[model samples]
Target: RHDKLAVNYMAMVKLAMIQQHLRAISPSDRT
Candidate 1:
């Protein structure tokens, strides 16, 4: 459904944002 696609997109965006935040918080320690 269209709603399901939208939810998936949002989840991906949130994940990307979290990753960026983590990178900014720690640039040396990567795992």
Candidate 2:
């Protein structure tokens, strides 16, 4: 049970990181 929770947390963290990276990159292309 604990392992499953850890995996889920890691997946969420990676997803958030990817989203943040996309947001960080998009503004530079506008200029």
Candidate 3:
């Protein structure tokens, strides 16, 4: 369904955003 796809897409986007935020705040965590 289109609505379900949209919800999944939003969730993925939010997850990516949080990941980016964490990475930006802690660059030394990659090790």
Candidate 4:
């Protein structure tokens, strides 16, 4: 159970990082 939770946490963290990177890049692309 602990291992599963850790995997989920890591996945979420990676997803958040990707989302933040996309958001950062998108604005530059618009202009």
Top candidate on lDDT is 3
Residues 1-31 of candidate 3 have per-residue lDDT tens digits of 6999999999999999999999999999978
What overall lDDT goes with each candidate model? Answer: 0.94, 0.91, 0.97, 0.92
After TM-score superposition, what is the CA distance of residue 21 in candidate 1 from its true location, in Å? 0.4
- Identify the superior model by TM-score, candidate 1 or candidate 2: 1
Please write out the lDDT profile of model 4 over residues 1-31, one tens digit for every residue: 6999999999999999998899897877666
For candidate 2, the lDDT comes to 0.91
Best by TM-score: 1
Q: Tell me the TM-score of each prediction against the true structure.
A: 0.81, 0.75, 0.79, 0.77
> What TM-score would you give candidate 3 relative to the actual structure?
0.79
Report lDDT (Cα) of residue 25, candidate 1: 93
Please give the clash total of every predicted structure, in order. Answer: 0, 0, 0, 0
Regions of model 1 farther than 4 Å from truth: none
Ranking by TM-score: 1, 3, 4, 2
Residue-wise C-alpha lDDT for candidate 1, range 1-31, written one tens digit per residue: 6999999999999999999999999998666
Superior by TM-score: candidate 2 or candidate 4: 4
Clash count, candidate 4:
0
